[model samples]
Target: MRSGLLVSGRRGGSGRVVGMLHLRVVCPVDATDEVLAVLKAHPGVTHVALFPGAAIEPAGDVVAADLAREATDEVLSALCGLGIDHTGGVTLEQIDTALSDAADRAEEAAPGEAADAVVWEELLSRTGEESRLNATFLAFLTIACLLAAVGVVTNSPVTIVGAMVVGPEFGPLAAIAVGIVLRRWDLVRRAGLALAVGFPLAMLVTFGGAVLGSYSGLFDRTMVLSAHQVDFVFQVGPFSLIVALLAGAAGMLSMTSAKSAALVGVFISVTTVPAAGYAAIAAVLGEWAICGMSVLQLVVNLVGIVVAAAVVLALRNRRSRTRDLGRPLSNG
Candidate 1:
């Protein structure tokens, strides 16, 4: 491990807490010195510990350190350039609390505050998990849409809100943007599959449910058409686009910042689930025009989100790269 001036940071005036990351690196014996050199050269790294030949499986040395969150992307990139990511192992964990003046000074030395920093590698890993097409993703989406259909039929905003909060569509959506920004077509295709395959399947399931409910007399066309409170799901308009754009930006930002609370707001703000529900129910009642409009609303929201999120990630990537050019990171 490289040892030197450990950087630390302070909170913003609004009580935004500073961020720290615990990084663990395992590398072959021959690469140990260069890895140490990189850590030693970084101002934002601190509390580095080196254990020679501690790695059993990979059979290498272990290097661990604390870093101001701002420096994580840079340091990881340099290490990857050394091919440690492929040859050995790299892991990261969040540090909730740190009590050291040197750590604070390390943050001060870092280029940016924690809230503003975009750790590309971290974002990619996190979103990569979210974008994977799995049973859980399909299940949640289907359940959320079903809940939303119930909410729409009953004209209950509360139920609709619950449905929105339950939906997991944002994960794949944000992953698409992240993939686009990083030029990871595999990530892009995987996320695209999650969205493309997931949404239609979920909506189809909801449509079947709506049909069953209609036969059982759970809801009829009159009640569905009478639903005014939650009609916003199919109310395609400029504001729909606006809300989607804002929500998409917030959703992507929440992923980068790790502000999960912001995610709840993002989830409730967009109408993806509700729109899908509305479309399914409308189709059951033979309300083709309304169904068409609801599908349009869904498309508008999805497109708006993708566009806004892509722009945000692109700009952040640009800013990070520009910083790299002006002040090159110590790659060792």
Candidate 2:
């Protein structure tokens, strides 16, 4: 049975009206088409996705009647006509309650927690069905990490930032966190393996490049210990952890949100690669202090990303549960 439904609406106002409507309906897959047809008839509905067993919950703030009465009435009439039950009134509280309920059920149907860690595996399973594990992705990762290492060695903020924009490691890490929470061993294994294998390889390759640069006169003592304007260094306080935490959260949001993936690149810029490059440079120079700082930076980023992803997924799950509790009608 389908576990949730989401319906959304918008209203026009005297000045400029911005309205959003979302609904969650729980029904079996066989009945989904009928339910979808009914929902499609509602006005001002922009997007609707159907996940048969996914979690759905009510979302958004309650709209004030003074603001959305006309649009609200039009939506109410349409819903009643289709035999799709919905609460009336344009109060913001009511709207929030309604949408939240729908979203909860949607989440219950397909929990993402267990699947989080195995993101690569899941991606492979999904895309591999259509195409082979393209070498392009791996190559890109390697190149990006190498560039970031170079950026650190040169103390070039621009190069390091560029490398961050190119790094694609966050997705796999997020998957691992999700896998860990959901106790999905497969996902955990895939994510863990990717991290274990990919991380060291990236570090090693980048280190080799740094060594070559040292031999080639590209690296110097000042560059080795110098922290870029964009790089986070050791002897640092809590701020590094905060940045990592926020970046981690944003990364997860980008992954789950269809329209928000664009922000993921920025998130990457704030984490991981720059620190990696710094570590490689420190190692090549035998700068213990700098190496320690770089290692701390890396650890901070890794922990922040993992913790943030896990917490965000867990919160989403809880909200979905709340919506399920509030939904009154049974989806047949």
Candidate 3:
């Protein structure tokens, strides 16, 4: 098997973190030639090897390559398009340490920015994992809703912020956006189910908590009526939608970039958990008007966030496709 050019280097070592990707692919005998061609033609790729009939179970030849992270998405897309992912297999792992001058050169030769690269399979895998509806997910939702309930009754913005931090609702919301963009109805359905079940279940538990708090005189109709912060939860208007839209877009971008720190801001900015809390408390106090308004606010924010995230993801995918089209397969 022919290999890509590997420049000799004296800087070879081990146990050093580097910005690179190690891709192990299993290619059918028939497709090995085409797969090798693609790998060699791509300048970002280096240190390639081929082992004939190495992979079993799926039964294919094993091909491994070291590449710059910036070029990974394009190479993965190309491989998928060539049906290597179906007839064989493709796996990617980040190199924790690369002690090689050749690796450094490979990184420098790769065009494009690493931060801007979007690994479609990786993104989908991550979001899919987050969309699972399990006890852990329910527990987080319960705690967030309860915190929101306490915040609503005591008018404590601190408690509300804490609830936002604890909440995992955004996972499903983001999954929905990704689903819509990728046209994966199953993802959309699973994410939708998480929301549909999570919210109502949380509200039900919080409603029970509200009843107990009312009996203990910790919460009452007068307190809710007097709490100025409660007004924020009940008010549904243009500003509420605008904030959700902005937060949704930011949340998706954060996920794509893997900068989870930004997601905390997204959680706190949305009214979903708080609105549910307020509605439950209002219902307990027989304040139907407040409850109705709070539910409306919740609906508006959810719709706004989902719509905005979907739009952002769609646009991002479009731009990526356009860029890929304009870029040549070879660096030269």
Candidate 4:
């Protein structure tokens, strides 16, 4: 069975609706006819091309089409059912900018609401890309944690917010959630490894930074200990869990809908960054109690966010399946 479906809808742009997807398919020579038929029959599909034996590596025919994003799931489903995925491959790429009247009409012809659409393949592709464990990911995490540590020592809420905004931890958390919903163990493992290594390295960097700052008389333990704004870092409770849950849900929604502005709120609402910073600072200061509590706070917030995102993604997946089952396939 196909993993999930994408909703197709119109986007408002000076009275022009946009939201088209460009697809490239490598198909076995014998299946080219069926694949071309599938593409040509879809109203949402505007441009179609076929190249016989064009894919040298795969030794197959190449097919390309421009279709409405909403029609992606159905068209892909048809291709998959024909054994295209096993014999060859299918790739979907979003069009960042398009200047075609045909594309606009294709969007209108596609069925469903774009805002309500959930393109599982696209979502998985995107999250998978973001969840990779690499230097960039590590650097962002380390810097974010260090900023959080600075925020703690200075009791600066602005610094804390900046740290939160800079952190890339949410990408892996969301990937984990999507992995669980999709039952993709590989994705789960990748996301888990990224988090496993990223957080500790970030914490370590902050720890070393704190030790140095203290030696230089730049950081005062008393400041963090006395700061009201920084107290939540070491206080993990039901309220903290609630905030993490809500923030995770909102973050997933923003990701699915491409409303990135809401993601900034998600960044600042969770306690992961602050907790990591506090734990590092506390450990350096020999305050074991605060260190333990800060560690617990980090765990709670991470778990809460992951669980909440998973629940939201699973629910959305279920709803998409239901919608797919109820709607009749459009025949162009």
lDDT of 1 by residue, 286-319 (tens): 9999899988998998888888999988888888
Rank the candidate models, highest TM-score first: 1, 4, 3, 2
Candidate 2 residue 105 C-alpha distance from true site, Å:
20
On a 0 to 100 scale, what is the lDDT of residue 247 in model 2? 77
TM-score, every prediction: 0.93, 0.59, 0.84, 0.86
Q: How well is each residue in 1-332 modelled by candidate 2, as lDDT tens digits?
A: 11222333423312211222234444444445655554454322324556554422332222211112112233343334434343221111112222332233333332233222122222333322322223554555567778877776666777877888887667567766667656666766766666666656777888898888888998687765555464464444588788877877776655543224556554454657667767777788888777778778777888888898778767755654564365332222
lDDT of candidates 1 onward, in order? 0.87, 0.54, 0.84, 0.85
**Which residue runs of candidate 4 sit more than 4 Å off their true CA positions?**
1-17, 51-54, 96-102, 326-332
Give the best candidate by TM-score: 1
Best by lDDT: 1
Per-residue error at 95 for model 1, in Å? 0.4
> Predictions ranked by lDDT, top down?
1, 4, 3, 2
lDDT of 3 by residue, 219-302 (tens): 678787888965788898899999999999999888876566999899989998988888888888888998999999989988
226-301: candidate 4 lDDT, tens digit per residue: 8788787788789999999999999899888656799899999998988898899999999999999999999999
Off by over 4 Å in 2: 1-137, 226-235, 265-269, 326-332
